[model samples]
Target: MPPNSQPSPPVSPDGTTDEDAVLAVRAGKGDTAAFGALYDRYVEAVYRYVYYRVHSDTDAEDLVSDVFMRALRAIPRYEPRQAFLAWLYRIARNAVIDRARRTRIQISFEDALAHPGVDQIVEPDAGLLALADKETVRAAIARLTPLQQEVIVLRFVEGYSTSEIANLVGKREGTVRGIQFRALEMLRTLIPSREALA
Candidate 1:
């Protein structure tokens, strides 16, 4: 690798690269550039995960900011038993949960289905069809249970693996797999038979 090559991407959280141990160590020790690099590496995935869960650009935006803030605050004591992204995601997930709890907010799955713009949660007004598609996908994701929703966001949306999810959520790998299966089943079952079957 070139001496000036860009930093390596964090582990897949699926058990691939393990460089997060090093990057995270540096970050935890007060390395702003390392943290920035970490943010550069995972911002999109983290934002997408929060966007899918909250289903509102306004909520997701605030939540993403909170997640990063929490991560920075918690970084000083971070332990690397899991991939850094997984740890960061755990923090992000907690922020989402906290936001909902503190506000006593109840986001209805049905409402989310009816209003897909919630998934565009981060301002997806690129155009009509694109905006529509974001809503549709977000609505589909809403059919899942909250746990499944988190898993999906971490797995598919954030590209984590079952193992990484296991660490992030403090669940066993088997549980994560089961959740994935059940979430997919619920989404399929709720959709039209043609779509489900096809």
Candidate 2:
């Protein structure tokens, strides 16, 4: 790739985030229709994040709903931190972590493997539409620590930029880059052929 060339962005499946951002702004002012529009735009991605972290459909569903509710309340103060989705993602991540801690349980690799279908995930290098079976990728991600898994998911599946992820996770940009590099190295060891996902 040329130095001047930009990395390709994940194709938006539903083709609608700009509209959602506008709606989010309106929703902050108490527009139920606007909020509903925003909800419809991102519920799937939010659910995917929650479900991947918690590995339970029930928990993910609850967390996604709660995250949005909190977001709604917080939206009045939502300053549009990272891109709106990144901001929403940050909220979802925290809720997932808090939910896991509250249960006095950590999601283990075994648990994640037990039900891989919870998140619609793809291979590390594949087109977003050509997702690997959720279980296979979930099991591989489970092999890493939650922090590593989170970075990997954010970098790959969620397609956050290094700077964006750092802001989302409250880490330095350099730290986020280092972690992403390390996560890839670890993933290579856990699952051979780094380019296979593509």
Candidate 3:
């Protein structure tokens, strides 16, 4: 709101706010400050999203940079029909997929179960015990099919609704819900008992 200052937060209480839409339009028109605002707003979420998929801090950092670079170039053609976050997330998703395909990074589900940084994926507010639970949960999520993993991450970790995820992933709402359901069921089966984690 101030002259030559960083733009205010793009999301309001309801999530995607009008400010996001307005700044996105300005950024599309070559407004550097506006684009910076969008970057500041989304960089962490995008990083976390990428980190969850790649399980490497270095790769996630590189891909986050790539996602923004691509977004900056593509914003000029972006329409305001969808929430800016949705569009941005789609970009992040593609970046992850592309990186996976290009590098052929493969870690089996059992390998992820042994991965030490699983707590990194848990929400920050979770308690120590909750972190353990989340670590177990995250490992289980890694075992899911790609579609199921996307739906679960978007719905639970990133807090997108079924419809929002549907739009981002180009799946029907019912299909997203189904993926989420099956993913959760798999997680329940795969996660350790609380006592085991403790």
Candidate 4:
């Protein structure tokens, strides 16, 4: 089945049952509704991850589609050994790498938001808002190495724990934490004005 294009998971006034792994297992068995549920759950996150790497709404959207397409095909092979989010993110990271290699794409993070759509994907930070432009924040992040970029985005933006990030990135937790620190240090240097964050 194609990736779920459903708007959102259903919720009654009381609550809704939407455990990701359960949905994934069901989807693995060719349950279209279950797969759609999974799609609704992860689409925004996948888009956010892709947006940071590609820095272009069009590219990010395309890559997100690709990620889901690949996911749909591979769900049958997915095991519950890890969180579905972790597995999905691994796929996304790989997709970005593959696309970059195929196209020889050179990402310019600062200029990525020149398109209107990406602005919605990356909520402007209070500090970044102070920069008086999203591009400034993008430029600051652009200066980070790819690993630094992933660490920073996952750490601060997505709020993933170091261990969780380490699992996703295939690094040790210490390494992920160190990368986060260095990425922050680089951002501090690149965006010297504290008010830029204010």
Candidate 5:
């Protein structure tokens, strides 16, 4: 509390400084270093999101680069209406959709299983593991609607809350929850219980 002292930056719930907005503001003003910082912070997250959807490491790497390029071009006009990561995710989601439209490539469950990141993507949950193997779970997830798959991956694989997912996907929190609920129900049917198998 000295007269010349400045207050510390705000911290997020996870204890990290919530500097993305500040960095974004700086980047908007042509600060390349600020933008680089943001890129370092979120490139992996964007890669994971894109990789899961596309199921191709080569394509995901290309898309991540494209997403950041698009974000760099578009950040000057960025508004902080939502978390910066959420805004970035919107860009990534759109990029994936655009690629899918261009290629018209259907992502098969077999391809998802063959993806190198498959084991990392579907970490075993005790309850789910009891019901089915990792391959079964991954296949069931792939079969869900795209929105459902997105919600599931963000919630479980990426450890995002429903509120965060809503912001990322531009949906109401309740809607995200409904998507998750229905996705789970569909998964249950798709992966038969051990008792049923017996």
Candidate 6:
């Protein structure tokens, strides 16, 4: 209970200690070691999340570092109301937005789609593959609304489940599904078939 002492770990209903909550509490009280443990545990997941959004390895790595720094500074104020990862993701999401605003850098849709993960999204349609080259796909993706683009990238590129995306975006699971459905429908319309191109 001392000001500098670590708090007891939070116990779940099943009586298991929540490791993340424990680390978060200790970090909140100035325990750099606990904060480092948290950083080691989540850095990769945060990197992937940022990388897909920015579509740049260099930018993503920089943003991931920024996210952790921000999280560390804010740890004293952090409440374990949600998963620590979710809180970190909110910081990352904001960092990406802030970088975009500061640099006015338009994310390259071609680069995003060039990632191997995107093949999984477009592979179901042979016509799409045959007709839509990187430029065509890029154009189609760029035409999507920002929210639609985010949903598409998170779902297809990051492979997050609807519920997980809902948590990250602070939307309902049903809403995430609706957004994904609408985004996919828009993509179908935007990307012409091979027959249409012919």
TM-score for every candidate vs. truth?
0.70, 0.64, 0.73, 0.71, 0.72, 0.66
Q: Pairs clashing in candidate 4?
A: 127-196, 127-197
Q: Output the number of the lDDT-best candidate.
A: 5
Best prediction by TM-score: 3
Model 1 over residues 12-107: C-alpha lDDT tens digits?
644433666677778899999888877887787778888877768898889888988888888888877656876877788788778867987665
Clashes (candidate 3): 0
Q: What is the C-alpha RMSD of each candidate to the true structure, in Å?
A: 9.5, 7.3, 9.0, 10.2, 8.8, 9.5
lDDT of each: 0.68, 0.64, 0.70, 0.68, 0.72, 0.68
User: Ten residues in a row with the worst lDDT in model 3?
Assistant: 120-129
TM-score of 5: 0.72
Compute the lDDT for candidate 4: 0.68
TM-score of 4: 0.71
Worst 10 residues of 4 by lDDT: 6-15
Error of 1 at 65 (Å): 0.8
Clashing pairs in 6: none
Q: Give the CA lDDT, 0 to 100, for residue 143 in model 5.
A: 66
lDDT of 3: 0.70
Those runs of model 2 whose alpha carbons end farther than 4 Å from true positions after fitting are 1-21, 107-133, 161-164, 167-173, 188-198
Residue-level error in angstroms, candidate 5, position 183: 1.5
Stretches of candidate 6 off by over 4 Å are 1-17, 106-150, 186-198
Q: Write the per-residue lDDT of candidate 6 for residues 1-198, one digit (tens) a residue.
A: 333443332222223236777789899999999999988887886786666456457877999989999999999988876567667777887887788788886647676566433433342332463467765665565556556666776666566676667766677767777887777766676665555555
Better of 2 and 6 by TM-score: 6
Off by over 4 Å in 3: 1-17, 108-135, 196-198
After superposing candidate 1 on the true structure, give the runs of residues whose Cα lies further than 4 Å from its correct spot.
1-10, 13-17, 107-133, 189-198
